[model samples]
Target: MTPNAIAEHFDTTRQAVSKHLRILTECELVTQKQQGREIYYQLEIDKMKEIDKWLEQFRKIWETRFNQLDNLLATIKNKKNE
Candidate 1:
């Protein structure tokens, strides 16, 4: 979407949206195309997928840790009841 279009969904200024778009464009997360007077931005799906894949590892680790904590708490509760 164009910067103005994206800005319309948010309460921020058009310049803030443009600034964020610029950062994303620089990071290769979004690509920009100039069509006449407007610059349209599109997300790089492959780059996003790469990011998701990288974050998946941490997600799994955190889930396991949370489960372990739950088990530990259950054990403590059981011991208290005993």
Candidate 2:
């Protein structure tokens, strides 16, 4: 999408959207192409897959911690009942 359309959708200024687009371009998350006078940005699906892989590692860590917390809470509740 064009930067202006993205800015309108997010209720943000065009400059703000441009800043974020620059960052994403730097990260290789999005690619830009010049079509006449306007620039269009499109998602780089492979780069997003890289992000998904990175996030999955963290998701596993958080899930393990949440399971431990659930066990601790259950233990506390059982002790209270006894």
Candidate 3:
């Protein structure tokens, strides 16, 4: 979609949408092509997959930490009841 369409959908200004689009384009997460006077932007699926993989690694780390916290909380509760 064009920046104007995205701006309208988000109820934001076209300039703001254009700035966000530029950032995404720099990250290679989104690509833009010129079609006559308008620029069309499309999502880069491979870049999205790479991001998903990176986030998944962090999710596992957080899950392990949460499990440890839960165990510590249980132990504290048991000690208080003793």
Candidate 4:
């Protein structure tokens, strides 16, 4: 999206959006393509996918922890009844 479009959606100044776009472009999270006078920003899908894959590892870990918590709670409830 163009800086103006993004800025309008976020209720921020175009300059701020441009600055963020610049940073993201530098970090390789976003890529820019120039067409005449307009430059369009696109997300680096591969990088996003890599991030998702990395986060998936943590999601599995959290699920295990939550399952353990549920088991512990059930055990406590059973003890209370006894």
By lDDT, the best candidate is 1
TM-score of 4: 0.66
Lowest-scoring 10 consecutive residues by lDDT in candidate 1?
Answer: 31-40
lDDT of 2 at 49: 93
lDDT of 1 by residue, 3-82 (tens): 99999999999999999999999999999999999999999999999999999999999999999999999999999999
**Tens-digit per-residue lDDT, 1-82, candidate 4:** 8878788899788999999999999989999999889899999999989889989999999999999999999999999999
Model 3 lDDT per residue over 48-67, tens place: 99999989989999999999
Q: Candidate 2, residues 1-82: lDDT per residue as tens digits?
A: 9999889889779999999999999999999999999999999999999899989999999999999999999999999999
> Which stretches of model 1 miss by more than 4 angstroms?
69-82
Off by over 4 Å in 2: 70-82
Report the alpha-carbon TM-score of model 1 versus the true structure.
Answer: 0.79
Candidate 2: TM-score?
0.80
Model 2, residue 67: C-alpha shift (Å): 3.2
Colliding pairs, model 4 = none
Clashing pairs in 1: none
By TM-score, the best candidate is 2
By TM-score, the candidates rank as: 2, 1, 3, 4
